[model samples]
Target: MADTTGPISTLPGAHHSVPAGVMCDDHPDRPATHRVQGETDSFGCELIDMCDECHGEWKAYRDTPQGGVCDWCGKHADKLRPRRDYEEGMYGRVYDVCVPCITRANQEAEEELERSGWYD
Candidate 1:
């Protein structure tokens, strides 16, 4: 697991504190207490900020399952799809992925290809 000691500052040109009047992306009314930066399964490699509630939601998404932790969604479950030469853009890597994450990634990739007129 990565060092989650404090609010990660991976956002470009972002300050340490949440700006005034900013609300949580998950909850529209609640004030954002924490700024979270992490990876998403289908959203490609990047960091995003979240409120405390959303942070909790993200943590739940990354919870370990019975088999092991998923490299994509970070969830743990009974079944995981293992890949030996998973091409992660700039590098070829090996990791175990949860079913839902794999499904979502496939769907997202198909959508992108369709949008590019390559999946027809």
Candidate 2:
């Protein structure tokens, strides 16, 4: 679980917070009043500032039927993730990709890391 206890601190491992009136990270038109923590299965332990409406929308998206054709493999997937590649601080086009393709990509990255002998 995420630790959301205490005042805002810049210390290491501290949970950062954005006060109200700040623009919602997902929705520019909305004002953020809450912070959403990242989960293990989803993303890193980063805190995202969101408004109540945006939060509800996020929940609705998660509750939606996870059925879509993967753009990477052109195959039907039970769960398609919105994947994007970042280069030079800019994000590329987002692709609805299958879990299997993501797993394969991770495996390839791991193999490449091992071959590079960075851990040795």
* CA lDDT of each prediction against the hidden true structure: 0.54, 0.60
Clash totals, every prediction: 2, 0
Work out how many backbone clashes candidate 2 has: 0
lDDT of 1 by residue, 53-100 (tens): 677776786564438788877777787754422244422333577888
> What residue pairs clash in candidate 2, if any at all?
none
lDDT of 2 by residue, 2-116 (tens): 2343322222222346664677787778777666653311223356667788777767876786878998889998887756433211224446778898888778878888999
Candidate 2 error regions (>4 Å): 1-31, 34-50, 85-90
TM-score of each: 0.39, 0.54
Angstrom error of the Cα, residue 109, model 2: value is 0.5
Off by over 4 Å in 1: 1-66, 84-91
Q: Model 1, residue 70: what's the lDDT?
A: 83
